[model samples]
Target: MSDTAATSSRRLPPANGATLGAMFVAGAVATMAFDLWGQILSPGLGWATLSPHGLARSLLGRFGLPNGDFAGYFVHFYLVGLLGYPLGWLLVFRPAWRAVIGAGGPWILPAALYGLALWVFAIGGITAIAGLPFFLDFTGITWVALIGHVLYGIVLVAVLRRFRLG
Candidate 1:
């Protein structure tokens, strides 16, 4: 068979259980790092709305949950960890998809793009559904969110690398 045929015919390996778990932990850490950054900057930046805790509070409140700051913490970490599962599983097990996305190189760019997409979905879709104004304004909160997302991407990439996950 030709090289291309052979490559195409090769099946991806199974997902590494340890890597998958590590990825989830990495995601949770990255998310918390982003939220911590937001909390640190929100006061001086005058963008308390950018706090993950605050956003989670609003989202939980919308669903009529006991939406305190503590509850928001759980919600934020849980969602972040949950989001990591698919990303980790697919990338770790599916080499073809990873190659297609150029994940073999430095992961910062793709991961940052992923973070930006998450921000768009959160502010544009989730916030809109919660009856809040969409992320139309490029204000401090916008900057905060953007920066936080980038930070999250950076941390996620770093942790994944440390864990030797694809």
Candidate 2:
């Protein structure tokens, strides 16, 4: 067989339940940590808004739902699990994708990329919908969010790697 045929014939593995679970759990943990980090610093800095929790609250209020920390928590968990599942599956089971991710040397590098992607989406998509500012202000909250996202990615990848999940 030709090299092209050989390469094309390679099949990717399907993600098992455990791998998916790991991804969701990792995402939850990371998001929780990120939120906690924001909460910790929010008191000191005036007008400092940390994380997407505020956005979630705003969205819930607009929708006439009971808007508060509960809304934020619900939305946060929803997004984390929703996004994490597919990302973990692709990172683990897709050969071409796996190769690209692995090429980054340390797993954290790819995880950082993932975090950046999430931040961009959250800032651009979620914040816009929630009527929140989207990376427009250079504030302490913004800086903390950036760092938090990076940490989220690092932790997510580390957890996945540790469990050999994806």
Candidate 3:
């Protein structure tokens, strides 16, 4: 193939029904893995449980919304997990990385870095928005959240790869 055609092929695939569906499923499964880590595995290992739903609830309350358990779950799971993060991965990060590196390298490192970015966004941005201290004052919960988010990223990438979508 011509160099131009090869370069174009290296670009991220356009968003379509199959791609979007795969992203959705991958995001959902990855989110579930994150929740499991936060709610079960970490606690089982004697770490503090990371309560993203509670953070979502607090943000809702700050905005004078109905900040109930269901509302929190909706915001955390539906809006952020199943929609926002996945789209950010497929639409933003993947494309930008491809543009930079020509999409020739392994995705693992990028996925891990993306997870680290997500950790910062969560611990730095989300917690602050929820009226919590930045990075929870770098407490045990902070590390726990970091691991959870990295796991989330890895799982999301793995699922996408499984579907041959990412």
Ranking by TM-score: 3, 1, 2
Clashing pairs in 2: none
- Full ranking by lDDT: 3, 1, 2
The numbered model that scores best in TM-score is 3
User: Model 3, 33: alpha-carbon shift in Å?
Assistant: 1.1
Report the lDDT tens digits of candidate 1 across residue range 69-98: 788877677765446433643354235446
Candidate 2 lDDT by residue in tens digits, 1-166 = 9987575444232357875676677777776667666666554555455756667788778778888897776776666534543374345433454555443456665677767766666665667677766663555666676767777777776776666643
Highest lDDT: give the candidate number: 3
Residue pairs with clashing backbones, model 3? none
- Looking at candidate 3, the ten consecutive residues that score lowest on lDDT are 7-16
Candidate 2 lDDT for residue 28: 73
Residue 105, candidate 3: Cα error in Å is 1.8
Instruction: Please give the TM-score that candidate 3 achieves against the real structure.
Output: 0.90
Residue-level lDDT for 3 in candidate 2: 81
Q: In terms of TM-score, how similar is model 2 to the real structure?
A: 0.70
Clashes of 1: 0
Per-prediction CA RMSD (Å)? 4.5, 4.4, 2.6
